[model samples]
Target: MSDKSDERKRAARDRLEQQRELDRARERRRRTLIVATAVVGVLALAAVVGLIAANAGKDDHDSQAGPVATPSGATGKDGLTLQVGADDAPSTLTVWEDFRCPVCAQFEDAFRDTIAELADSGQIKVDYHLATIIDGNLGGSGSLRAANAAACAQDAGEFAAYHDVLYRNQPAESDDSFADNSRLIELAGSVDGLDTPAFRNCVEDGTYDSWVEKSNTAFGEGGFQGTPTALLNGESIFPKKGDEEISVAHLKKWVAEANKGRKPATAGATPSP
Candidate 1:
């Protein structure tokens, strides 16, 4: 009887021990899982932060921008469009751009010299229309202010110089640094005689704000897709999606080839009204 009792107690104690072992194993698994999950979350967060940091400074460098000014001596009509190249050129290149646009800056980088060459040589006439679609798209006033400031430069007859300067110093599309009017004035310093008091007051006063609005309206109504849109001889070269890929050399070749067979427009041909 005593042996039987002893055996019963031992069995109970053994079962309890087994249960405790099971509990301990489960606890270990829980802790390990928690640690692993925490580590994965930390890694994921770190990766996201790194990505954002890397791309924030997209195109614009920290240095003040400088533009290679190309003068076609075309037109500065309505304080909006600045025309360059010879009026009698057979090919007409019309461009719509914004100061805060990175892609437009890319186009400027690749084609500025080429455009200058064609316009200067009277191979093509280039018309530049400043648009503030970026301001509308990005929810900032930089586009408007920058366009106005460019217009201010027009009065000084340094539109080409300041235009180049603005693109040179254009901030990233996400950065609204161009919205600060002071920076606009500071950028004016890049152009000779463009940083004067009149230019300063003009930028501060937002003198051409109305014209910027008008230009934006024209851009919206012009049936265009996006910034850096270019039209050659009143034909769309930048169709929305699925259009042929475009590059600097492609553009230059397009112009050169087009000029070969282009018929010169009659004098007084619908002056950019």
Candidate 2:
């Protein structure tokens, strides 16, 4: 009887020890799972914090829907053509040119001063139509980009100065440097008050790209070919025959003759379509 009692007590103690061991194993697993979950959550939070810190210093404002509103009193088919001088002026000199067009650069350089002087003196109204034919021909975005930048400058009331500066600093026809937005901003700085934050955003975001496309289409639909096309009083005045390299003197004389022959002047003659 004593031996049986001792055996029963040993068996009961063994079963109790096995239960205690199982309880310990379960507790260890629960602790391990808790610790792993905590570690994973902390890592995920750290990654989010790092991402926020990285983009915090950037000025990535969402682009506006379209270009700044056209400057007041400017008239054209949706600002596709930039017109200067009194609308009543006797002669309307319409010019079709692309910023990246080599010949356009030459024409601008040669006749820039005369054109500006005449327009300022109320002798003629100059209409500048932007074109991107060079972009299509040369496979670069420079023509379109530069044209858009010019429109942005127009919004700042610095179109004339900016226009001259663009032609003055025009890159080689084969080079597409103007395609870079940074370079376009650099050019804007050439014209005072043209490199503002608004202008920068306009150029970077291509605010006037649609306008440029429309102007290019207008150039084609107007039955024009190539850049540097000149029209005086709605008549093609592109140098011809022996007048291939027309001089400023000849241009002034031609304007004088056209003015002399203009039927009684009206002060509010908008450019012919």
Candidate 3:
């Protein structure tokens, strides 16, 4: 072959090889794209499944029966009386609580079971007085809204259930953590037989404003300095300074002492003169 012909043939072969390499690179890219798409699809499916499982768990735990009144007659100074235990119960225990207070939450958890047991056994009656001392700290009107919503819930006969849910979902003490009206209404809907429409309307219109204000005033007048303040048989049950632990033993001792000569007062009963 002549030299020029040989050079032309070599150039043709080089061109063909380049085209083949380009085809292979395109194929590799296509395969990579396919694998990436499959991985993304699997991840999305996993996330959806996780969300469903979480929702199911929450539903199971959130289902609770309505309030169970243990029935005793005791009324606060504000004329807000609750039937706590049996009529023959020896004494009454009153707890003033703020929904947004962490200390109140701790005290509730510590003494709730004991109080419930005593109420169940017809040994004592318990009344929970809701107040809004933490309103200023919670930024929004969450403290007032929650307290009002609770009263509305109580009116609908779902107070205990609503109460439990409120504490369970209480946000941290910060401006952003305040529970809004919508959130309160949403929580009210979780309780069985709770009139959602009525609850929402009441919350929006601040229907319980007067009632909440009265309770707040009564709480202040009753000499409660802070949230989680307790009273045994209508007298302040002051825990010793630094003895913040409201253990079962201490509570039982207090109740026993309070019941020595105490009698069950009537509902809406005022404090003794």
Candidate 4:
């Protein structure tokens, strides 16, 4: 009987020891899991912080990227207007255009000769305002790049010719070919005395990029609906003036009536568009 009692006590002691060992193992695993979770949380927080810092650096670089270099002889508000006719002409024709806008290209194609005749005859002065709405609407920099290149052409005293050239070689609405500086320089070769080192450097360096940005911003603030916004004497007259559809004859008649008794500008000769 004594031996059996001793054996039972030993068995109970072994069972209790085994349970204590299992409890210790569970505590160790819980501690390890908590440490692992804390480590993962710390790593995740560090990654987020690193990403924020990187973005902040990029923002700083972008803010100080380019200088606001306005083209020479730019007139009107903020020196954004590129005038293309006699300064003292009787009527003022304000034109807002985008390089990538097909409608603007169509308008130019339809009225280029008439508008040039009017401008050259000192009947009206054309105020050209460049915009980059297409670049904004589409996900590309073609409009901005082409506008800058045109501004560079303006600096070289070939704005009218270069402007016509750009329209003549304008790409499709979805095509961003104008973003290539080489292509812009290549186009400049067609203009007389326009494909110089200065012009190339200007296009390559994006000298007028900030000016283009400013012009785009102004376009947004002007409450204008879209590109090819034409105003004669501060009144909208694009597709139609009042009741009459705009035509070549109508344009001449309107200018004639506007300048009824007034004499045409006798100032210096303006470039033919």
Candidate 5:
């Protein structure tokens, strides 16, 4: 009987020792799993941070692209303005536009004829300022490319015609079709005498890319809200002027009022109004 009792105690002790070994093994596995998960979490965080830094660096590089090549006949501060009428006109119509902005296209469609007539009559001068806000917001280079192409057209002395053509053939805001130099060149065919080798070279080479970037930076620094920001004689007059909603008649009336006593721009006068 004593031998049997000792044997039973030994068997119980063996079972307890085996259970402790299993518990230790489970604890070791749990600790390893926790360490592996932490390592993976850190790696993922590092990857995200690296991606952000890389994108920010890319943006900085793009904003400061090589030397600026100002377009021919460009005027105003830093040669950023693309004037579309006699500079001596009594009233100056300042238009800040983005090629990829649908609202700007709409505004152009609505007021293109009236604005053209007013500009032609020497009653108002149009100062066009290009911006690339859409490209920054929508993750594409269409705005920059199109603006550069337009600057090329300005170099070719077909800025007015090409400007109208771009709006007429403007693609959907989401479509980055204008980013293609070939597409911009194809559009240039609509403007007579504007699709020459020199113009094509300018578009392909992005001669004014830095200039466009500078203009975009200025737009951001100007405290302006959005595209199609139209101002008349330094007063905001788009969609509404004071309490009156902007219309074709209202636009004409406003120009007439501004030019009440002022003489129309005489031929051969100094270009600066």
Candidate 6:
């Protein structure tokens, strides 16, 4: 072959090699895109599954128990009362509670049955002083809103039912979980005999603000610094942690001892020991 022909053949071979390299590069890019897409899809799916599981857990926590019964015609100092137990009960059990406190919820769940039993037997009266001790800008508004709504419910003669719902649907200890005024009205609607319009108006117009302030002041005067504070017959009851689960026996003993010196029909007149 002539020299020029040989050179032409070499050039053709070089061109072929360059085309092959280009083809390989394109294939690598396509494979890389496929792998990246698969990784992204897997991450998204995992995130969705995690979210579902988290939601399920929260639901389980929220739906754990049935609604507790509220007592009737339970009264307190300053006419700030709740319909928690029997009207003619011999003794009074006063509870100081903060709307935003979780321990109060636990205490409610633990003692609700006992309160119901005593109230039903006409043996005891329970009074709740709803206080707003949780303050600050984050979600303090919710605590204020709920306390005000509770006072409004009391004004409308549906305090017990509304109180039960508040404890039942109490939010976790967070700003977002605090009950707003709108949410308070919404919850009040679930009570059997609650006057929705009156309750809403009272809440909206801040008619119950004075009552809430009174309760808060009472709490301060009563020396209640934290939530879930209880006074049996006016004597402070200091509940230990985990007391809700295993402390009923102790409470019963205390009640028995407390009732020994008093006459059944005239017990409320006597101060608790």
- What is the C-alpha local distance difference test score of each model? 0.77, 0.82, 0.70, 0.91, 0.90, 0.70
lDDT of 6 at 68: 25
User: lDDT winner among the candidates?
Assistant: 4
Clashing pairs in 4: none
Regions more than 4 Å wrong, model 5? 1-67, 268-273
**RMSD in angstroms between candidate 1 and the native structure over all alpha carbons:** 13.7
How would you encode candidate 3's per-residue C-alpha lDDT over 15-126 as one tens digit per residue?
9999999999999999999999999999999999999999888877667522222212325544455445555577877778888888877776776678777776666767
Predictions ranked by lDDT, top down?
Answer: 4, 5, 2, 1, 3, 6
Best by TM-score: 4
Model 2 global lDDT (CA atoms, 0 to 1):
0.82
Candidate 6 segments whose C-alpha is farther than 4 A from its true place: 1-76, 81-83, 86-88, 136-139, 176-179, 240-246, 261-273
**Candidate 2 ranges with C-alpha deviation above 4 Å:** 1-74, 241-245, 261-273
Q: Is candidate 2 or candidate 5 better by lDDT?
A: 5
Q: lDDT of model 2 at residue 130?
A: 89
Q: Which residue pairs collide in model 3, if any? A: 70-85, 71-84, 71-85, 72-85
Ranking by TM-score: 4, 5, 2, 1, 6, 3
The candidate 6 region of ten consecutive residues with least summed lDDT is 264-273
Clashes of each: 1, 0, 4, 0, 0, 4
Candidate 1 residues 1-273, lDDT tens each? Answer: 999999999999999999999999999999999999999999999999988877665444433333322222325544456766557888888999988889999888877887777776667777888888888888989998898888788777787778888888888899989899999998888888889998899889887777777777888888888898988877766632236556667777777778787754444222331
Off by over 4 Å in 1: 1-79, 239-244, 261-273
lDDT of 1: 0.77
Report the error of model 5 at residue 265, Å. Answer: 1.0
Q: lDDT at 144 for candidate 4?
A: 90
Per-candidate RMSD, Å: 13.7, 13.2, 18.0, 6.7, 6.9, 16.2
The better-scoring model by lDDT among 1 and 6 is 1
